[model samples]
Target: MTLLEVEGLRVKIRTEGGEVTIVDGVDYAVEPGQVFGVAGESGSGKTISVLALLRLLPRGATTSGRALYGGRDLLRLSGRALRRVRGRELAMVFQDPLTSLHPMMTIGRQLSEHVRIHEGLSRRAALARASELLAEVRIPDPKRALEAFPHQFSGGMRQRVAIAGALATRPKLLIADEPTTALDVTVQAGILRLLDRLRRESGLSVILITHDLGVMSSIADHVSVFYAGRIVESGPPPELLSAPRHPYTRALLDALPHPEAEGRGELQAIRGLPPSPRNRPPGCAFHPRCAYATEASLEQVPLLRPVGERRLLACHVDPFAPGP
Candidate 1:
């Protein structure tokens, strides 16, 4: 079932000079019990796009779009209505656990407050739910752990607590923004496994936002590749990794260091910095650095189009046949 559908989602900030568009005409949808991954490099608008949907953009930022969830437009919800929907029907795990968690509040207090406000549970019942949630996230001695503060747990454990709190109300959808970015590799793996397991057990749909393709591919059933303020391509991992149809998509895949090519050459990297929001290049934003750019590409923006079932691409130059 389609749980969320976002269309023509655009964001612009009132800058010193003028309004600078951050994300432009980005669209995607998430299904129930499916893991939909949004992947890109830093400043690719991956984070902002999701943030805009939740009406979490900074003050003075404007968002125009339709985010249909449960027969309502989430973008049009009032503050109180949105709050009612946010943690109860939908939840989010932010990028930094340290910053997202309240250092002053006890873990138990934080988690219980989340439940009491959303579920209308009594203090004792909410505390019991918090303990159960901590256990579900596999925190060692969950009951004892609840009494400790956020700082007492390691980075990975803190994230687990965040995840547990998000899941406390049994939300239908969870948005995880760079959940593993701050952890060590081993800890990152554990968190990934934990998310996958939770989805399996609860039938919870997820939208995981990250710049790491490897991380997304490991857990996401489908992936959307975002470029400067837009999605350049999207598909299943096998279709995209095997035969990407856009120049930018191909370049991103070629840049990965494969174990088969460990002794072949130095790791490839995409040259040129991402465009500044205020001064993006005209036409295709990537045309300046694209290997197959042409005069046509320099003058026209390619709209995202389907090349196959469940696959999309946006590039003037074809992967198999470069434009003249």
Candidate 2:
């Protein structure tokens, strides 16, 4: 069963010039217990797409399309109806724990408050629940740790608290945007492990948005490569990572540092910059930077179509074709 199905999800915001499309015709599904990863460079609309589902987009922004969660259209939901779904059924963990967590409020207070609101538990009960949540995230001495403020804990610990807060309501689906960003290598590994374990233990589905292909390869069952507010390619991690069907996905992999090439060669960088949402190029957005771009790529947008088993590609050039 699918936990969430987003189709033709478009987000536009009014600018001085006119309304600019930030997310254009994005579509995907998150099955129960699946880690659906959205990967791309910055400004690819990965973060804002998820924000649209939560209705957390900035004022004056308009979102179109269907975000069907548990058979209900999240986009069409009223404020009160959406509030019922936000914490209890769907929750989000942001990139920066410092900004997400309250600096002045004790960790317990923050966690307990969420539980009290969503679960309707009394203060004492909520505190106990909060303590358990901290322990679940592997916070040391969780009971006492809860009394400490966000600043008292290390960066990783603060992130764990942020994860715990999102899980306080036992949400079925979690959207983690750059959850491991800014942490050290070991801390990043730990956070990734924590999320994987949580998914395994609770059958929780996740929409993980990040630019880290390493992170996606490590934990994501499926991956979507985003570019210029659209998905360029998507498939299971093994096939998608090992042999990308889209030029952009290929370029991204080539840009990753290879251990064997550590001393032999420099990391390859993708040429050209991502287009601004307001002035996106016609046809394929990645054509300017793509090595395989052809005349067709500049003429019309390629629809995301199935090219292989469980794989989707949006490009004029087929990487698997016999001739150039």
Candidate 3:
């Protein structure tokens, strides 16, 4: 079942000069117990799309289009109604644990407070639940860690705690933004394993947003490649990873380091920086950096077209098309 659906979603930030579009007409859906990955370079509007769903965008930012969660329109919800949904029905594990964690508060207090608010549990009960959550996320000695401050934990541990907090309420949907970015390889693997286990055990839907295509391939059931505020392609992980139809998606996959190809040559990196939201390209946003772009691509934007079952690509020239 589809637990969350976002259609034609557009987000613009108001500035002194004019409106700068950050998320442009993106569409995606997440089903129960499915991990939908949103992959893109920095400034591709990955975070903004999640923020828009929670109505957490900063001042002067405007969002339009439908965000339906459980058949209710999230965009139309009042602040109070939204608050009731957040942390209980839908929760977010932020990119930075330190930023999300209150420095002055103990880990126990932070976790318990959320439980008390959302679950209306007693302090004692909340603390017990918090301890279980910490252990569930694979933290060592949950009792001792509860009294520790955010600074006391390592980067990986802090992120685990953050994930614990998000799962405290056993939310139906979890949005994890760059959940493993700051961790080492070992820690990243551990975190990913824990997330996979938790999702299976709890049957929780997830939205995993990151720039790492390898991570997405491993964990995501469905994948969406975003470039300059728009989703250029989306499909099941195997299809998208094995035979990416969009140029941008192929570029990302090629950029991944391959130990087998070590002796071949230097690693490939996508040339040029992501375009500024204030000055996006006229037609296809990625044409400025796309090697395959031609004059035809520069003249018109391509809407997502069906390439196969559950696969869509937004590109003028299909990579899978027969050669001349």
Query: TM-scores of all models?
Result: 0.96, 0.97, 0.97
Q: Please identify model 2 stretches exceeding 4 Å from their true place.
A: 260-264, 321-324
lDDT of 3 at 318: 83
- The per-model lDDT (C-alpha) reads 0.88, 0.92, 0.90
Give the TM-score comparing model 3 with the true structure, all chains together: 0.97
lDDT of 2: 0.92
Per-residue lDDT of candidate 1, residues 75-115 (tens digit): 89987899988888888999999888999999999899979
- List ranges where model 1 is wrong by over 4 Å: 321-324
- On TM-score, the candidate that comes out on top is 2
For candidate 3, lDDT tens digit of each residue in 1-324?
Answer: 789999999999999989999999998889999999999999999999999998889999999999999889898898778898988899998887768888889999999997998778999999999999999998999999999999999988999999999989989999999998878889889889988998899898899998998899889999999998999999999988998889888888888888876587676788988899999898888898888888878988888888779998999878565356
- What residue pairs clash in candidate 2, if any at all? none
Between candidates 2 and 3, the TM-score winner: 2
| Clash pairs for candidate 1 | none
Q: Candidate order by TM-score, highest to lowest? A: 2, 3, 1
